[model samples]
Target: MHATPLTFIGASVSWGKLRSAVTTWQPLGVVSTISVRAPFLNTIRLSSSIHHTEETDVAAIDLDEANLILDILHRFQEELGAISDAGDRLKQSRSPEVDEYRRRLVNVKGELKNAAKSGTLDGVKRPQTELERCFYGPAVQHAAAHFRLRTDAPPSMWLSGLYDPAGDVSYYTHGLRKLVDEGQII
Candidate 1:
């Protein structure tokens, strides 16, 4: 009997393998692989057929895979697309490249969070509020307080939705759940 590979391997590894398969192998310049598992893409393909230079006729995608793609797209929309208007300052500018960078950051955060939740990373949650989206919440006060005590930084700096440069911020970014585990930051 034939077997599906994913039956033995976990979803996290499946995602990684998919990433590697797509990234490591560079295809021809004219070749493109658009994995549009979303049902709405069929509608879009139909509506925008006039603008296309080449015909795109591929086998119908599996519904389960389509649902997964739809879910991830929804998550991305929730996490980034809505907030794209006011953006992540990657290199002091909000360009398309910066937006792609932020999207990749979110993807890494999601994948790592999924893979390590049972052991390595714990007590981690998705960013809910706008401030929490850009700035680490627990680290916010620590960095702000460090700036306050050391530099005598004014309260307005923190109040104005700005980030202060502090070393402890790394601790918050990398090992946030550990902070909660050790009672370091609540």
Candidate 2:
């Protein structure tokens, strides 16, 4: 008897997805993975007849659609600060600033509705530095509602929870959580 090797991609949505598939491996089936980051990543691969590629969509997102929504949501920050700031009561009594924010808020809300109708989601790498975290933290908050998920609805944050603002930080939302339990990204 001859042994053949099967390799799994390291960047799958989650290890839970591959748990059952790996258990079915026979002695002759050599399971292998290529990973430099996560030691245990890349352990699941479909055999020649395990499943079709389309099935993987269950773990993936429609980037175009989610990106549109996310993009619009965060754009509200262009004038002064984001709507999260408003929620945080960061908006001052100055009439001009308040009015601008109100105007932008209405605009962004309508746009987000359009985006929800229009589409889904894709993966985003976790921020590693303080500045990166600070910058993306708000985006994470803006996009957090999309995280809980719904049938056929595009995901908002596919990566691990990235924006848990500290009590001392300016914002207060819980932030985005992992879409998959484990193994979504690096």
Candidate 3:
């Protein structure tokens, strides 16, 4: 008798929801509450009927919102840099922050570097595992949200819509991809 391999499924569903939220949500517009009805196996069902609303078109987001998102991304990048620099300093000597976050950053960086060197960063060759997919889902969504709110275009548009906003998202995504490619959380 041959036994079948049972695959874990919940992570994919969660990832899908997160991905949808990222791709569809607008920065300034409020996202309608999604209600799931009926128990469908391996399917995401929203209770609210999906209908075409007039707000689907991507417009120029306000300057204030764009500036706010840009500020947040810049801050996040600075935090990552501080942590990384502190870790480097610890390796050479020692520091107070090393005891808490710096050391952790060093360890994570090493692990991610190794993972990348081992060719695990190639998305086509080896897809991100369920855990990774779940972890990245939120980061991507948050970045996208920042882009959407900060950008003056529809959510359906890619990062190339607005010049300054697009540049911000590009920088943010570049940093984010570095951490992800290294297999570390941002």
Query: Model 1: which ten-residue window has the lowest total lDDT?
Result: 41-50
The clash count of every prediction, one per candidate, is 0, 1, 5
How well is each residue in 80-125 modelled by candidate 1, as lDDT tens digits?
Answer: 3222233332335545765454454344334323322321111133
Off by over 4 Å in 1: 1-16, 19-89, 120-186
Is candidate 1 or 3 superior in TM-score?
3
Model 3 has an lDDT value of: 0.31
Arranged by TM-score with the best first, the candidates are 3, 2, 1
By TM-score, who's the top model here?
3
Give residue 154's error in model 2 in angstroms.
Answer: 32
For candidate 1, the per-residue lDDT at 19 reads 22
Which residue ranges in model 2 land beyond 4 Å of their true spot?
Answer: 1-81, 87-94, 121-176, 179-181
Model 3, residue 135: C-alpha shift (Å) = 19
Candidate with more favorable, higher TM-score: 1 or 2: 2
TM-score of every prediction relative to native: 0.21, 0.28, 0.29
Regions of candidate 3 where Cα sits further than 4 Å from its true position: 1-56, 92-96, 103-170, 173-186
| Model 1 TM | 0.21
